[model samples]
Target: RAIAGIMVTIPEYFAGKNVLITGATGFMGKVLLEKLLRSCPDVKAVYVLVRQKSGHAPSARIADMVNCKLFDRLREEHPNFPDKIVPMSSDLTQPELDVSREDQQTLVDCINIVFHCAATIRFNEPLKDAMQLNVLATQKIMALAHRMKHLEVFIHVSTAYANCDRSVIEEVVYPPPVDYKKLIDALEWMDDKLVNLITPKLIGDRPNTYTYTKALAEYLVQQECGSLNVAIIRPSIVGASWKEPFPGWIDNFNGPSGIFIAAGKGILRTMRASNDAVADLVPVDVVINATLAAAWYSGSQRYTRPKSLLVYNCTTGGINPFHWGEVGMNVSLV
Candidate 1:
């Protein structure tokens, strides 16, 4: 069944719901927006939480967001997508995220779903910087969500690499390397230079700050489990899908996208990774679909469940295994 112009199995479920999504300008957020608009044309509104950057207002940021190539297909289908997609100014790093009282009240009054995809995803970010974005921002979002009168579900996006130190990953949240609260307290008193000097010792064997903070954020979500309906999605090395939208279409060379694009041009010769290890690249559209499905799942069972939180390991290792070398050659040839 199709509802509000979206092709979905459960059309009536989200036909006219007001949803709020953070990280609207990110890679996956763009795909999620396209999917929802194309499938659910009847959705009442989508309030995107974006920061006021470079002195631009929230509306201006949204205007630029919709004009991006990611929304080109949506524009073709509904040339006036701006009418449904609304951007709300917010700074996740701020104490209260800089969300005005009016905006907060607006969200509480209307929002039914919240997708928290905003976070600093840099692999080399400093400890303090990473915590500011990944951990503190999450806590602030939860605080706001707790005040929502009509909030149904909050979906937090986390990386599968949060537990990369383990040889095999599980579907449950793992204990972080350090006591998160203690770490935060220490960082609060320490100078930036002092924090940087001890980052290596603090993080231990973790490859980078991104993974370290994400692990802590997972625990933070657990602490708020009693109050908020949340789900944590851990996606491993998200890559271009084999199908959907288009194959071989990718933007940015930060993650495996870099390797794929490099291999395509035959410029990137070698890289670091266990050749035989399973490649867990998931498609953007697939993850977005799973996210929406999870939201619906959480919403439908709200009464019976106890402010539930589900953790999904979005990996293709057990079902289908592709090696890095195989992907390299495949991208090079086919």
Candidate 2:
């Protein structure tokens, strides 16, 4: 690996190139942003799409995000890193992602890379909300990418479980259960009650609306990318960081992290799962690294785009070192 510390080509590809990222404040998004600045310090600018939340304006949220614990090392090193993070007001659930005319124009003119990370992750999110955020939002972003003058590559973050309806998962986009357009049009007339009533039926053998829509989003990406280079990253059961951006860096208490924390604190907890069953838990940073590398590969040949779609399924299976019982024992000892 370059003789133990040589600058690599991934960073070189990003050097002086403007990058646009949605979901910059989310868990994986934060790590991706920090890594881009820390590893590719010469990147021209990172335009993050942010919408007002909890009474905080887009700019305020961006400021707070850059100053979070995640970016401590980055701040210590590159004091001017904040200058490179430009916040663009946006709401993915709205038309055109709620991005302003001027901002849209700016991105169209200058953006080199686009990372679509914003989505409704809540498993219980309503069907209508899920469709708006997951499927239609993808289409809106694709529309924006089509108009970009300097766009090199578009990276879409999807879930590994998106194709859970299948017996065996492969590194490819499976055909969606239903036509995205017909369903979207149907939802327009149906109220939440109607949508919820038929949510399970509509999802059809898929576990939740989240996975169901993600599958549709993948198919939509393939259809809408047109001539733009595109790549998709499917990460399963993303957990805390293994290394990079500091160890044990995680804010959410989901999956294994939640179980261990509650168990350690003597919170009344009993769960059902076979210890021997493989947990496809992958580190967030590892996913980010794979995503960045895929971006480079997608746009390597700017003129002649070789791969129209690069799909990466980031998950752990087969033989694995650790298991739930072993991990639980260690946490209890602590």
87-132 in candidate 1: lDDT tens per residue?
8888888878998889989998988888988888898898899999
Worst 10-residue stretch by lDDT in candidate 2? 1-10
The TM-score obtained by model 2 is: 0.94
lDDT of 2 by residue, 1-334 (tens): 1324443488888998999999899988999999999999999999999999999999899998787788999999999999999998899988888999999999999999999998988888899999999999999999999999999899999999999878788788888978889999999999889899999888888888899999999999988788888989999888899998888889889777787788889883666778886677888999999999988767665544455577898887643446665666777789
**Whole-model Cα lDDT of every candidate shown, in order:** 0.82, 0.87
TM per candidate = 0.92, 0.94
User: How many angstroms is residue 285 displaced in model 1 relative to the true structure, after the best TM-score fit?
Assistant: 0.7
